[model samples]
Target: MISTTVAAVVTRFAPSPTGQLHAGHAFSAIRAHDFARERGGRFLLRIEDIDPGRSRAVFVKGIEDDLRWLGLGWDGEVVHQSARFEAYRGALGALGSAGLLYPCFCTRADIAQAASAPHGPEGLFYPGTCRALDPAVRERRMESEPHAWRIAMDKAVEQTGRLHWHDEETGEVTADPLRFGDVVLARKDAPASYHLAVTVDDAWQRVTDVVRGADLFEATHIHRLLQALLGLPTPRYHHHPLLTDAGGERLAKRRGSESLANLRENGADPAALAEALRRGEMPAL
Candidate 1:
């Protein structure tokens, strides 16, 4: 439940529970938590454990444990994306009923083989092959083949028209859903895609400001369009620079960036560590 504390600003630190919390996670979490705390507003922690196969309960516990060790206290009960499948289904149904989404049967190899496939921030986007299929053909294919749901960018644009969203770092940016080209709303592995779940959750939580890393800056364009389509309010975004290692490379779990658990176990002071990040100084673990 959203706190009726009447605080003017509300922010959140949402992390995927697929691995141990690292230094980069700490920086983003602390920045969001402090932004709310300093303004006498509410700070929220949301578990973005959308993928059931990869997300482990131990990792989820580790995330909360690390946040506690860092001295960050959120205002309300933590929210979990896994528990909100029905809500996501409802939103997906809403989009489908409005003819804004269509089923995509293309696999990774299928997408890669498509001619003239344009690339977006993530990589080669969907080429909308299945989108051009006749309704009978699409229905027939849906009967036997597993598929994902994708937004129809062109049709969606016609419905909503030109739109824009605000960003603190880059000022206002015009929304460009086409660049993403019919991004997935639901995949076979998860009930809801990151874009759909996040857009829905932010509005449900009444988050007024979004603070996170700059990597997801491009996704804001699609999120902005979803908000417009669903009639949800757009939150002010502040995409801060990603925390980097001593070599000036951004930290990542896939690349084996040192986890905060590893750092804390090595005798680093949590309070001091938080202060070090606030000072823009990378700590020597």
Candidate 2:
């Protein structure tokens, strides 16, 4: 029965299966979960397993186990990016039909050597090298070599015009899609790039509030643009501060920091560990 009460608040905790969960992940997950529960909302869990090169089954299992140990549970079945390839492909096609997508044949080295290439928030922004390629040339190269599909940022922005999204942490923010240059939508090895997949999935899943780390604050600008392009509703964002080490370095998996699994194995109490994490008292180092 549709109670017709106020719509339920929806949140999500999306983690990639690249490495074992760490202190930072614990804090983020607990925060998202608690935020939703406190408001009688539903919290979702998404497995960002799009990057086949780095994602692993073991890490996926470890994420669930660590979250459980921290006393966090999500509503509904977990959504896996690997299982949503067709949807991503459709989104790409939609953008392509709108003349907002193009193929790029340049490798990372080629972009680095391009004398006129401009730098943006994400490393060297892609110069529109293939954006003006002869159709025959592009077709030939695409059939013979690897390439990534990138959004025609200028064209896409022109279509959307001036746009803005609200962020709970910073209030209304103007969209700056061009700041990322012509961001990739799909890659050679992967059907969809991180930007494409995330925007498509979030809208599909009806995520109301995005709660994640502050490191992704800049990326939100691109996300706002994608939402406008795809004709999807925008959700509020909350970029929380990251958990840091004793030396003030941020805790991260790639840095080889201790994992939640190791902490559990070392006799860390789940309830107590959760409390300490909430209070920012854990990880004395």
lDDT of each: 0.90, 0.88
For all predicted structures, in order, the TM-scores are 0.96, 0.95
Stretches of model 1 off by over 4 angstroms after superposition? 1-7
- Collision count for each candidate, in order: 0, 0
In model 1, what are the clashing residue pairs, if there are any?
A: none
List candidate 2 stretches off by more than 4 Å: 1-6
Q: Indicate the worst ten consecutive residues by lDDT in candidate 1.
A: 1-10
Report the lDDT of model 2 for residue 101.
88
